[model samples]
Target chain A: MQQSNVYIVTFSVILTVVLGLLLSGTSQVLGPIQKKAVELDTKKQILGAVLEASELSKMSGEEVFAYYDKRISSKVVNIKGEEVEKDEDGIAIIPENVDIGRNYKRKPEDRLYPVFMFLAENGEDVESFIIPVYGAGLWDAIWGYVALETDLTTIKGVTFAHASETPGLGARITDASVQARFQGKRIFDESGELQSVNMQKGEGRDYSDDAHKVDGLSGATITAVGVNNMLKAYMSHYSAYIQKRRSGESGGMAVLN
Target chain B: MSTETAQVTEVKKPAEALLSKRRKKLLSDPLVDDNPITIQVLGICSALAVTTQLQPTFVMALSVIFVMVFANLTISLLRNTIPSRVRIIVQLAVIASLVTLVNEVLKAFAYDMYKELSVFVGLIITNCIVMGRLEAYALGNKPYDSVLDGFGSALGYAWIILAVAFFRELWGSGSVFGVPVFDQISGLFGDDFSLATNGLMVSPVGAFIILGLIIWVQRTKTGYVEH
Candidate 1:
């Protein structure tokens, strides 16, 4: 069937309008639910760093959100270990709103780091501090939360997620069992210099005695190096806060049990 | 494939039965004889990417099937009005919209699957099976027949990826859909017995090897040879 130029132009216009309207309508309808799901997932990841994966898995979406609300308090800080109450746009900075990927692109000194404090049952003392770290993986961006014990040197736990890392290899970073290996590992050496836990190349070797090294995925050398550099860079970026807290310079230490 | 397209175009009966012999063939042909992956070899990109795990591959298959059926129907309905000069863009628009719908629904309902599949979901827009169906089968056929053809092609794509995922997961991770099948079998023996999974099966190269073997076996059985 041959069509006139007028008919073709009219058909294209109508088709474009219909498709545009259809897509926008679908997005509008599903926007809230998608946003809620994403918010819950982010909370789950942060909680996964501090709590058990099995425990987090057992809770529903509302329960997770409620648990996060009840137990977690957050504050944003700059590279100087000073609190950043607002962003450059004068919007109040919250842990939920701080984009680690965007912050990672900026200069280290200019970045705002969000610290999520996992509160104890009494809700008075902090149990572990969860910090977000972001970097490149083998194929794409990788990021995760690293939870540090009250001493601010030992790791309590960690939870990793990647955009497009190789599954069963570089993507093993997201595995809870793999993340469990970081438990009890120390980030600072005996000399008080921040070493930041390293993911050494190769897997299934004993790093139990090592203070700053963990066994890496076998076939994912680049992703392991990515994690290593990410940890080193982010830890040193937050070292000011770690050092200040370790030295009891922060007033929060006065309330420590 | 050209013969199949020619057969579709030759049928002009306005009141043909919904499940006529021709339509049924359209539905069944892609399962093995004219498969999108093994036979036609259209959508090998996602077949490799999502087949590492059974769970994500299953979800990916369903997403593609949904996108294919609807995109085919929509394009077939509009096939006459679509300007031939800009038909590719129109087909792309329809497929992209359907893919976005799938992506949104998955994000809203199955967030875990959504995260697991990630970029592969968006890549469905570029999957040649969907576009090939739109241009070849849908543009020339009735809406209902086009839907059946799309479903058949998607099913063929699905089964191949699911099969790839099955072996990949079983060997690569010693599990099936996250269940430890190999580990349990190993446990039946003494503690000395343990299955060490082959890491090669977990990578894209694994998908390549599995797909290659699948194509070889399929072609040998069907007596299909490229001249």
Candidate 2:
């Protein structure tokens, strides 16, 4: 059957209105739940850097949130290592709310760095500081969290995630075994210069004795290089904060220790 | 005589029961005889892309099935009113909306699965099987028959991709659904024997090779010859 121009126009308009309403309705209804899921995932990644993945996997979302509240406290810091209570917009900066991906596009100095501190059992003393890092991978964006011991040089643990990478190749960055390679690796060399941990080319090499080198994925040199660059860039970005903490520890606590 | 029989059947088709033999054929024929992937070769891109792992492929299949069935039904219901000039656009709008719904639902309820299948779920809007079925069957068929046809085509697409994933994940990662099967097999024997994983199977090339073999086997069994 032939449809006249007026009828066609009317049909198209009605279809657009109906579909627009339906889509907007669905989005509005699901928006909060989706936001919560994303928040939980981010928290999981942050905690994954400090806690065991197996343990985290077993916890429900509510349990993970409770555990995060118990063991973690956070603060935003500037490039100069000073605490940032409020952002340029005058809004109070919450470390958990900081978006690393959005900040990644801004100038290094302009970015707000959120530091999540893992508190010791006494709950007051800081155990390890987990810093989030972001960069590009071969296929898409790559990001991770790195936890540093109180001394602020040794990597306590790490967890990596990627948006799109070759499943068994570049994507192996998320593997626990791979992240475990970063444990105990120091960011600062003996000379006290910040030298970020390197993911060297090729796998199966024993980097156990090396302070700054971890084995790379065999077939994923580009992704390995991406990780190497990401670690170096983010570590250097946090260097000022690290130096400040280091000096503060030695300066204030000299008699107690 | 054949023309007279065809006319008689055509006259009787509308009054037939919901699950009549003709409708059953509409539901079952696509499994092998007119498969969206193997025989019709309609949605080969996703079949190759998501087949690298069983878990994501399974989710992809489910999403496609959901999208296809609903898209077909919606289009069939609106078949009479849809202007031929704007029918493609209408079909696309319906399909895209349904896919967005699936995506939003996944994000809210199964976030991990949503993350794993994010881009692929959006890509379902472009999968030709949905469009092809909407145009070929839904535009002229009744709603129930269109739905059955859509389900059949989606199932046909699903089984092929799932089979490809089975081989790919089993060989590529030496696992099934993330379980390290090869590790267990080696552990069963000891250090004396171990099967090296085929890394090629983890790549898109592996999907192509596996899909090609599947199409070849399926076509050979069905005796389908392309002119």
Q: Which candidate has the highest lDDT of all?
A: 2
- Which of the numbered candidates is closest to the native, going by highest DockQ? 2
Mind giving the per-residue lDDT tens digits that candidate 2 earns over A60-168?
Answer: 9999999899999999898998889997779888798899999999999999999999988877888999999999999999999999998899999999999998888
lDDT of 1 at B90: 88
Q: Which ten residues in a row have the lowest lDDT in candidate 2 chain A?
A: A248-257
Off by over 4 Å in 2: A253-257, B1-15
Off by over 4 Å in 1: A249-257, B1-17
Best by TM-score: 2
Candidate 1, B138-217: lDDT as tens digits? 88776888899999999999999999999999999999999999989999997999999998999889999999999999
Cα displacement (angstroms), candidate 2, residue B202, comes to: 1.4
Q: For model 1, how does the per-residue alpha-carbon lDDT over A1-257 read when each residue is reduced to its tens digit?
A: 45679977998899889889998998899999999998998899899999898898999999999999989999888999988998788988777878889988889999989999999988768899999999999899999999999889899999988998887788889888889889999989889988888888788899998888899889899999999888888899999988877777355558433
Compute DockQ for each candidate against the true complex.
Answer: 0.52, 0.56
